[model samples]
Target: MSVLVVGASAAGLTTAEALRRKGFRGALTVLGAEYHPPYDRPPLSKQFLSGDWDEARTRLRPDNLLAALDAEFVLGDPAVSLSDHTVHTAAGRSLTADHVVIATGLQPRRLPGPPLEGVHVLRTLDDAAALRNALAADKRGGVVVVGDGVLGAEIAATVRKLGIAVTLAGPQAALMEAQLGAVVGGLLGELHAAEGVELRLGAAVEQLEGVDGWVSGVRLVGGEVLPADVVVVALGAVPATGWLEGSGLTLENGVVCDEYCRAADGVYAAGDVARWRHEDRLVRLENRTNATEQALCVAANIMGEHQPYRPVPYFWTDQFGTKLQVHGRPSADLTIAEGTIGERFVAHYRDAGRIVGVLGWNAPKQTRTHRMHLISGEGHR
Candidate 1:
């Protein structure tokens, strides 16, 4: 059997690897929109943007391991459309396979305006490099990061570490309040403030003030202007599904799929591009770990193993030497299961009095143990 995986990033590469490891000795082709090999993306905001790690260090696998897989890699050619089992690329190549996997990932959302210099969105390696260059070029001007999500917070932390002034602006009451609740998110805001990052939360960004087609500052809705030479827009992303418009797939937010990650007969999707049925709801996860985990489930289903992909959503973030790990969905009903909120704690999140999530702030070991409470249906003691 021949398999065609459209996307050369972590999800696509991991799907190919999982297939080979599961005894699939078939013709495999991994099509990529980018020229570079599969690389880790989380570090793009921290280590890569800060210049602490080189390009080579971000690679997910070495040359030898990739060669061992023996999968044909078609790089620099993006899939433009899909018709049945055949995929048409931007370079006008039609590739057919018994099974086609869509893992095209996401595209960064940009502000409504013409493209301006010194303004960036951190989604690709090139985006990180461009933002890094813009920051290193001048330490004199401040940087206003629009968006208080995980990406925006990390970028602000990294930019501040580079001795550049950073102002984090967003509509949320606290940093990542929508994800981690007000208490933990407020603590995170305190952490950033302690590190010299100016927090301008609870306000929406109105527009970008620019000079000579270069970003000069970010204007807020309430007439507050945060002046800066560099601006990073981490306003989140949408699934890269423009090419799949006429492909007959139910595209709403992402590629809709069954519980098994199957979009149709002999066709599937993984990673951020996949919004599959899990339990009673359709869910789409946009984290590196989910990319690999969902790809593995897709590969198993492709091999006729027939299993539903139900995963407890988990993600982590690192900034200012502190690592925060979140297991399951964090809700408002939070309880301090261990340690103190001031420093090193594992907080439990409940929904209608049932333990549903766990948040570890510099408490990895305790978090792992508390995670079992979420998995085994046990209440937090």
Candidate 2:
């Protein structure tokens, strides 16, 4: 029962580890596009981007731990296509196995503009290093971040800490409104503003302005130009499924899979790339926690445990020295479960009178305790 994982990142690596932990002694191979060993991405926007941590510190696991798994890691060669249980890499390597897992993750969306020098997107380790160098090189220049979601807000916060003037422009009314809701998102907006990040909310970016092939500023739809030396586009990302095109696998927003995380007879998917049926709907989660959790479920099912992949969604973000943790889906209907918005607090999100989400604002201990509310069904209605 040989297994082939087509990504060496968190999801792919976790799947291989879980397989070994579950006593599966089959051939295991982990492939990656990046030459660097599997590294954590969440830090790319904060610690890695700000140079607080070096590249080695961002690695998910040390060399000794990875060696214990005893899996063949094919790095720097990306999977270009998949035919049945065999995957063809760009390096002209054909790898076949009894089971193939797709955990290719996502590719960041870029803005439609000139290929300017200072325009950037944060996705991989290389992208982070490039952006970090650009930010550090420009001592007197400001940055214009063109997204209001979690990634954009985090980048702006991280860049501002470097003493670089940051202008956060986005179509959303508040920062992370789509994920954290308007009220809490607005509170986050205030936090950014208080920390000297200029907010340009409710504005559409028309295009990028450049001089001599270098980004000079960002032009909004209404002809307002936000001057900047560097522009970071954090619009969002789509699943990396271009390689799976015509692979006979259903690809919508991601690799479509069943409740068992199986896309076909011998093919499975996990992490950001796998959009599987959850209850009545198909859902794809893009967080690190979901990546590991879904991979474990996939590995167990492959080992014949046959368990369904059902998990309470969880994600956390740290910005400006404040840590925000969210459990379940955040919504517009929120109640102050503990403390006040000005200080540490936990908020419950309700939908149709049922508590559907929990959010902790700098209150990790209380947040963990309140998370049981969702698990124990104590706040269902």
Q: Compute the lDDT of residue 306 as modeled in candidate 1.
A: 98
Measured against the true structure, the TM-scores of the candidates, in listed sequence, are 0.98, 0.98
**Lowest summed lDDT over 10 consecutive residues: which window, candidate 1?**
372-381
| lDDT tens digits by residue: candidate 1, 1-381 | 999999999999999999999999999999999999998899999999999999999999999999999999999999999999999999999999999999999999999987788888999898888888888886566899999999999999999898888999999999999788999999999999999999999999999988899888899998989998888999999999999998999999999999999999999999999999987789999898899999999999989999888888889999898899998888999999999896999999998889888999999999999899877866432
- Return the TM-score for candidate 1, rounded to 2 decimals: 0.98
Q: Which segments of candidate 2 are over 4 A away from where they belong?
A: 378-381
RMSD of 1: 1.4
Model 2 Cα lDDT, one tens digit per residue, 61-99: 999999999999999999999999999999999999999
Worst 10 residues of 2 by lDDT: 372-381
lDDT of each: 0.93, 0.94
Total clashing residue pairs per candidate? 0, 0
